[model samples]
Target chain A: MARTADVDDLVARARKGEPRAVARLITLIENASPQLREVMAALNPLAGRARVIGLTGAPGVGKSTSTNALVRAFRRQDLRVGVLAVDPSSPFTGGALLGDRVRMQDHASDAGVFIRSMASRGHLGGLAWAAPQAIRVLDAAGCDVVLVETVGVGQAEVEIASLADSTIVLVSPGMGDSIQAAKAGILEIADVFVVNKADRDGAQQTVRDLRNMIALAAPEGWKPPIVPTVAVKDEGVADVVQKLDEHLAWMEDSGELNRRRRARARDEIEAIAVTALRERMGDLHGHQRLDVLAEKVLDGSCDPYAAADELVEGLTESG
Target chain B: MARTADVDDLVARARKGEPRAVARLITLIENASPQLREVMAALNPLAGRARVIGLTGAPGVGKSTSTNALVRAFRRQDLRVGVLAVDPSSPFTGGALLGDRVRMQDHASDAGVFIRSMASRGHLGGLAWAAPQAIRVLDAAGCDVVLVETVGVGQAEVEIASLADSTIVLVSPGMGDSIQAAKAGILEIADVFVVNKADRDGAQQTVRDLRNMIALAAPEGWKPPIVPTVAVKDEGVADVVQKLDEHLAWMEDSGELNRRRRARARDEIEAIAVTALRERMGDLHGHQRLDVLAEKVLDGSCDPYAAADELVEGLTESG
Candidate 1:
């Protein structure tokens, strides 16, 4: 009862906009704590309130700088903001992520702004799998807008798009050409494209390239808008915000918002189920059955698929 | 019986170093055909013969060029070689990968050389999950050496390591500091470090920085050798090959090879089992049970954990 009361208390404080409680809850999620089930149960009803906007780009594309500028801009409008800086490349939550946390000290004193850096290093399914849960904690904690800032390298950009209501893909001049961006797979996921560091050389060309690619791709619904911004100077961020609002409105009117959220919920549920099963499977491995099968596989006595069948059957029978 | 004979004929041809048969078997793997179970069972006995070498680095770090040079080196000794250019970032098998294949035309005419490109875009567990089986195909087909070249951005580098007997982490001058490499989680995984593009500026600094980081990391067992190379020019490639052989010899002498192989087998079996369960889980979702549970969670009537529990229960009962 005391532990249950503690989870209830934590959720209550988080709902009241206490940053420490919000931080504690996210830490719980990050650590994959035993009490997570109770905490999620307590917080689930209070979630689904915040608008999640994901900002993603390759490293050195000014993702964090852009996020910092966007946070300041949102604070100007008096909106409560939560920033989840997810680094999928790092296996642990330290080093460079801590540096980002330090750089974000500009918002440290603002009670309306909560910033957290998560590293996906040791996580089973990586940070993308755990990020939806972190987002829920931030959402339940009364943030009006949650900015999920992730390094949009390769698969991570796609995963972030799935988590956010509106995804902003940042590209810098000299990073690569439009074909390179296409190869990186960022072209398909951008709801809003920010040509960050617009003051740099070839910024205009970057914008042109994006426009040409957008025309070529010609997505079925809700064509993505490109916004140019020198984020450090705070130039054109308001337009970025305005475009986000427009995208959100379009999504709402077009029923895309509802559909996206439904898909998110479905993914979240499946990820949770798979994780639970994976943990169970880990236990099965500990029982030496997997090792026995692995030995057989190594010796070529059985194929992996056949060995897998035996393991799955054993799991089902045990269950 | 004809289908079985067809599979038998294919395996027999592949065992005789027939390129088309090897290519067909890999195609079957990439497509995840139903006959894979039979193919794997047949291949399993013939695998565990090749020395698997994984080469990974950030894009533009000359992973493919290095792989190409190394393949040429391996072929000089009259060793049958298999090259798997795995693009975890790309979802499809064409475009850039095909371009790489074209660049590797030097090996196209060689009957002893088999080269294939795999994109992890639509793969269930990504290419890393599928790569082991593909490696087995090459291994069974009688490759004395199998080189896996993957872009080492984030988690893909780690996944490639699990599938490799010797993992070579490539870095280029001006790519970043050793700290950046460390942040990328490459420091811990490198068995041999290749300072690629050694003709470029800051090449020595890159090597020095890596030395510093490796000194600080101070990994137990084998110390990774840093080889400087301009892979395009085929410079220092022989040293890389020598290092690979040394690492392989060290592994065998120290029993690390057996341990690594056993671990690989364990991971492969678990991945297969997980994939099978995940596919079944997909089937469960099609029954509207997951959608219904997702809806309940969306409406705040239930949390994901409870819904996952219920789904797991249902799955077990149905099984």
Candidate 2:
């Protein structure tokens, strides 16, 4: 009950846009603290206001620079923004992405911006589940727009992109990035495509390739636009922001926003339920029981499915 | 009982090195068929004999060529080899990697060799869980060795590599691939490093970079050897195979093989159990219940964790 009061206080501070309170709330999420449920319950009513946008691409695609430009653009309109730079590769390197975070120092002293780098450690479902909670923190903290940037084209990146209201897939010219993006099946998730470093020699070809691909795989609604930019120089960024606004308007008008949000909430609730079930099973049976089952499966006394069935039965009974 | 007899007959045929039966069993795995448990139970006794080797790299790093070269090298010694070319990118393009799979036309006629390309669709745990069961099928089919080649540096690739007895990370010269690999945090999982395209420019630098990174990390026990190979020409392919054999020896002598296998089995069992629990919950509640709960969460009537708790209670009571 004391902790409940503290969580309420924290939520109040965060809702008033106190940077420390927001940071502390996210830390609770990252650590998966026991106070998390209390924190989420407190923050829930204040969220659902921030528009979430996701950016993803390969490592050297100027994602950080692009993110910085977007942050500046959003701030120019006096919009409060939050950035979550999620690195799926660096499990051991907590805060190892300080260099990238340093690249975002333009917003360090600005009260309107909150930039945090997160390492996707081996949590329950990795970034898929943790990210939405972090986004919720930013939303509850009164960020008008929250930007999520994920490195590389891993499944986690895809999942995070799906969670966003608009996902911008960044590609640099001359790297065959469009083809790589296509091969990685990232093209489908792109609500907006940005060809950064557009002044490069192969920029036309990159745009052409993307245009052709977009034409071929055009979905029923919301044909993703390709915007070329030199993000490092802060060129064409306002156009990206405009496109984002247009996409958000379209999403809201077409009822896609509500569907997407509901889908996201459904996934969030399911991930939590599954994680809780797993933890409960782990607490009840421990590794010793699973180890025995695994040994039996290995020795041909049982199949994995059969072992799993027995374990689930035990979990249900215990519950 | 009749289905069990059929599963036993199929397993017997697979054990006799019948390619059709092996393909059938793997098809069951790909589809997650109901007969999978019976097949796995029948196959488990015959597995644990074959060495499962994992090769991973960026797309143009010549992984398929390297796999082909290794298959040739292994077949020269009359060793039965099974290759699972897993393409995580081509989930919608089922069997769309026919071109790459066709490149192994050299071994297509050889009954001693079994090659299959797998697409890691949206399975419960994706490739991490499906791959092991597929490998078990190959292992039970009297294969002396299994080679799993995964594309890109995604988390799934890293996970699949960890499941191998010896994981070979291939990088080409002049691509900054070593740096990319290091950034992907895959350097720690390498049991053997193959510098493919060794004759290309900057080959020495790539090798040097990997050496330095390895030296810096310096994992204890079984230092991974860097092997240079021009796999397309089959030059140094035999050396790579030799290094693999040596790594296998080290793993066995160090008891690392058993440890890795047990760990893999444990993960497999846990994935299955979690999937089973999720399915049971889904069956009991259906999407309507989840949608209603999600609506409640979205409307601020409830938070995700609280909704999850209620769902779990429902699952437990229903069970």
Chain A TM-score, each candidate: 0.96, 0.96
**Prediction 1 TM-score vs. true:** 0.97
Off by over 4 Å in 2: A1-9, A93-97, A177-179, B1-9, B93-95, B177-180
Per-residue CA lDDT of model 1 for A1-319, tens digit only, reads: 3388898899899889898898888878778787889988988899998999999988889988899999999999999999998878786666745775686678777888989888766777666458988999999988999999987777778888889999999999999777668877887789999999999999999999999998998898899999999999999999999999999999999999988887888778777877777777668857588778888998889999999888888889778
lDDT of 2 by residue, B1-319 (tens): 3388888899999999998898888878777787887888778878889899999987688998999999899999999999987766556534444654686578877999998877776676678668889899999998999999887676766787667989998888876655567767777788899999999999998889999989999889988889999998999998898898899888889998888888888778888888777776667656577788889999999999999898888888878
Going through the candidates in order, their DockQ values are 0.76, 0.65
Chain B TM-score of every predicted model: 0.96, 0.95
Pairs of residues clashing in candidate 1: A91-A121, B57-B152, B91-B121
RMSD of candidate 2 to the truth, in angstroms, is: 2.4
Chain B of candidate 2 versus the native chain B: what TM-score? Answer: 0.95
In the predicted model 2, the residue pairs found to clash are none
Q: Please give the TM-score that candidate 2 achieves against the real structure.
A: 0.94
- The deviation in Å at residue A188 for candidate 1 is 1.8
**What DockQ does model 2 achieve?**
0.65
